[model samples]
Target chain A: MMLFFKECRKILFSLTFLIYLVAVIGFYITQFSHDAEEKISQPMQGCEDYGTIAKEVPELLMPEAAEGLVTEYLSGYYTAYPIGFYKEVKLSEKKSAKIAEIITEITGISKRELDGFSDFDEEGITMIPDGNGGYTPVVKEATLPEINIPDTMTYERFRELMRKADKIIGGGSQYSDDNIVGNFSLVPKTYEDALAEYNDIFEKDKITGAYARLFCDYMGIIVSILPVFAAAALANADRKSRMEHLIYTRKISSVKLVLTRFSALAATLAVPVILLAFIASFSVAKLYPENNTDFLAIPKMSVGWLLPNIMFSTALGMALTEISSQLMAVFVQGALWFGSIMRDTELTGDIGRFTLVCRHNSLYDRNAFMENFNEFLFNRIFYTVLAFIIIALTIWIYSEKRKGGLNVIRKNIIGKSKA
Target chain B: MEKIEIKNVNKYYGKKHALKNITLTIDQGMFGLLGRNGAGKTTLMKTLAGLHQKKNGSITICGIPVENTTEIRSITGYLPQEFSMYPNMNVYEALDYLGTLSGMTRSERKKRIDILLKKVNLTEHQHKKVKALSGGMKRRLGIAQALLHDPKVLIVDEPTAGLDPEERIRFRNLLTDAAEERIVILSTHIVGDIEASCEDIAIMNDGKILWKGTVSELINNARGNVFTVNVPQKYLSQIRKNYIVTGMLIQGDYSTVRIVSDAVPDLQGINTDEPNCEDAYMYCLYQNGCEVQGGDE
Candidate 1:
């Protein structure tokens, strides 16, 4: 217990921990606190511009979808997110012909005409005379040609064809099943739909739950990447200061030493987040004093949702640092965080099971979160288990290091750097 | 009666043999291990400290097998060649932290830290951060932390490697004082350190112990074999190549040189001299067919 507190003090006084705190507080003040101050419910007047929900309608307008395809094909390049990384996939002639064939089926345009369609339509602009008697050029808006769609094909059939097109494009194009719908938006919700969502937020989420999920959404992004810096610094400090041999020769067991450090880092990193949760809970309570908000909602969500991310990142840092004796864990965790943030397209909808950062950006639509509650539970629990497993692996590596079996990590790192 | 016994201990770093068929018994007091830079002194010290696993040997520290690292570590305190602690911690805080790791009670740590700070002459600098301390002060703090738990065995590797002459002498005296009731294994390439404090000395080269005996016995082994002769400056290089020249002093047109050879050369004004520990160490390495060079100043 004394060792654990000492380790905590060591981390608290470290510069890396200071950077982490600044980032956490910076993110909270910049991204979350403003939202907490604005008490706009979905049914209120300005809700239309504030929240955008995913409503997967059973319709796909052919002209709109076809025009987007033609524009992408004519541009000679496609934007995709294959495997959660942004990739610019350039197609061969054969792939371009395949896309043209799909475009011909949706509209009456042939492959030749589709290829000839320009990216923009030019409009003539008149010159404007300045007060100094010199002529200034005024540029006109350039618009693309609008295509006409036949009424014979249904939306479902068009979706099936687009899915096939996405497959031919290697699965990350905007036409892919995962992203085709994101290119379009649902019609604005009616007053009834808005009122229903507002009621759900009040009855189901009980005011604080709605705000808690939003807090988790923003806090999750920072938590996913910041704890790693602290963990890596703490793990590498002994080696950096040339203190490993002194500690290794002590009578402390590897389990005790590693667990103390791990718990200390995890707990310390979670402190700011827990404090933010309390502040957010109070803000929500003050906003709706008569609504009888569940004050425990934010605190519960912070622990249940955000704490897992902290544990996994910190544990991973410790494990990788123990194995490689380098700060390689930071890059690994950074890549994972970047991928999760990029793949989180449905920010206000169902939480994905594999994403490191779970997003619920809205304070309404309790039904979306409820729909995938099981998967969200599994995701949090799985990360918690994985964090423990990684911690156990860290303990094993530490023991090996004490026995001098793992000195090759340090030797190889030093040798390569010196060489 | 605490002692460490090693029976044919052999250790290898991959195919490179680091300690080859080593066998020795170290009793309570200061035991000096003298060797060159890469002479396996550190390997032997780490193996005894339970920081390295020996391949084909049995080591028992006070009747506990070296494989039982927890038990061995409980009674051993090691100060590696690169001595450091948490740089952000103060001297007293660092000692307290390590003491907690050693499972000392709070009161025990508090009392022992004060005593050790005074003993290492670091009481005045106890509140200073470790990074702010000078090299000599840091080494003294290292000694304090190692003795914080009062282990039965103390293994210090190259303790005086980079210290100034004054700090080195002070550190040697500290080690001598520490060995009053415990086993202190001081490993270094500085022969003067061993001569000043150690009685039992061992000379090692290429992972093998070349000689082990009292300092006087080692000196006697090379007695009558060391000679000094004043030669012209031009012949100094040639004489150095022909014999293991331990020391050379230049005066005017002639260079007075000390050589460890079996017989005196044909040079005039040759005089036999008493062998010091450094001369005896070079002669032992010469007799073992190991490459001998001038001391690394």
Candidate 2:
């Protein structure tokens, strides 16, 4: 342990990780082009346009008769369903139809023929009115021809079916009599009809948050992990030059070597991550004031959520690097951690949840930092344990491999004892 | 005095035999392990250093089993065949860092760093990164680093491989100086290094040592049987086919050849004398049932 500490001081403390800190911090703070721009282009009115179509169809069909049903359906559908950008590329009609059938089979909706619909143009979207003044979809509202089925199908399947029906509806012009009677003049007659629609997803007036802040927090995660790469480079620096044979043969044990190298590397990652977390928090609070920014709260999240995760990631990287080629090991682990950050939203269903990179980061929950210091401490403990476990596993694998090759214990003691 | 004992060492890298039935004992003072490339010299060194495990063998340095690698390593300094050091570190920094790893205190590391820097003649470039050093300086650095902890045993594999003749001589002198107090085992394909510096040497091939003893003993053992013949250049190949040609030199239109024989050649008058370590090395290799047929037998 003493020897490990000594080595860490010399190799890990060298000015190697400085570059990584800058890069990670730079990446996070840099302005990213977002898919939200598409939302911005369409505006908040488009959301209302969708809501308007659902509400007005039945009212237009029966002027004074059935107001409650149309409003209820409109409120229930729009309020209940959350909107998100679909990631999958547009599928062929046949593939889309097959997927739709599979979904409808389990959804209990009668298979409705999609005669005319436009997937792209929001203007093309329209609702069919029931003779009783309730709104229904004009084309196949559901893909199957009805049998009771559960609604467990994913949103992806639903969106795919919607897209398929939209293509057919836009290609031709056919509305059932029920839909024809409720046709809304406020809505477009074709795909080009609704040029200006209101967005109901998240109101533009109620800015949820600044993207720059999220961008900065993301950079903090990357910066904090820089030490790991620096440590890895230093750890293998000796090995690359053939000094490992000499160094290992010294009083240093394989386990000590592994730990020392990990410490240096992990510390290297921590320095920048911690600093950037504070900076990001401060920047968000000061620069983007419209969002009621909390600079003090923001820095806490960086230390809490981002730092530990970076350490764990760096530990994992160093451990692999110890056992394998340094370049390849760092590359694989770095890419994995990066992927975890980028895919965090998709993986956890919430961008705020702990990703592989953010699992133990000290810079996570800003609110926890100020309001519940104990909770903040608790969160730190929770993530620190998680990070420690991963780091421990990395050390175990590394030492085991360095002792001989992989499966050293199995090969040396176990096999020998068995024999 | 400490001794390194290799007992029936057999190493297998997943069934590809590397070292086979190797048994030897090395004591304090200079020793040479000579072999061609891929002849298991490195395997033997690695096994002794505890870098590689032997399938069946017990190696003990100074009565401590080689499996007690950490303890053995504490007293042993090894320079590998292809040594590498941290390129990003300057000469002083690399030595200081390695010194710390070898269990030297910071003050002790600092003291040793100065001594090593001067010893290797790298004092001027003490602040220069390792990557900027010349090959000779790097080898010198390898030597200095290996000796830093003042280890009881020093194992250097192919130490003079890429060094210029002057550097090789200087390094041999350094090894000879260090060997005065420690067990220094130098493995190399060069016969001159063994002949000049090693008091005792072992010649290994095909994973086994064919012969081992002092250079004088190796030469003395093959003394009487060597002969020289002056033959036409055209018939040199024919004579070589019939006799083991140990040395050859073209003199005018005639070729002078040295060969080992139990009896005088049938061709009549020819001068003959004692053989050197090189001849003894060739003779020992051939005598150990090498597939290469002997001419002038």
TM-score of each: 0.83, 0.69
Where is the poorest 10-residue window by lDDT in model 1 chain B? Answer: B288-297
Tens digits of per-residue lDDT for model 2, A257-361: 666666665655666555655555454445335654444544554555556656665665566565555565567666755655544121211222223432222
What lDDT does candidate 1 reach at residue A401? 90
lDDT of 1 by residue, A1-419 (tens): 78889999999999999999999999999999998987854565654453444456645445556778777777777776665455677889998888888877887688887655563433456588987989888887645445666788678778888887787778866776645554553446666767777787788778888889899999999999989888988899888989999999999999999999999999999998999899999998999888888998999999999999999999999988877744578888998898778763667754655667888887666666776688689889988999999999999999999999878776796577557
User: What is the Å distance of residue A155 in model 1 from its true position?
Assistant: 13
Question: Which stretches in model 1 have alpha-carbon errors above 4 Å?
Answer: A42-190, A325-327, A413-419, B230-235, B249-256, B294-297
- Clash pairs, candidate 1, are none
Instruction: Sort candidate 1 into its docking category.
Output: medium
In candidate 2, how many Å is residue B111 off? Answer: 2.2
Tens-place lDDT digits, model 2, residues B1-297? 499998888988776888889989999999999978888998888777777777887889988998887788788888988986777778888887788778788888888878877877889999999899988999999999999988898999999998999999999999998899999999999988999999899989989888888889999978877888888888887888877777888998998888876566665457777798877887788778765454444
Give residue A35's error in model 2 in angstroms. 18
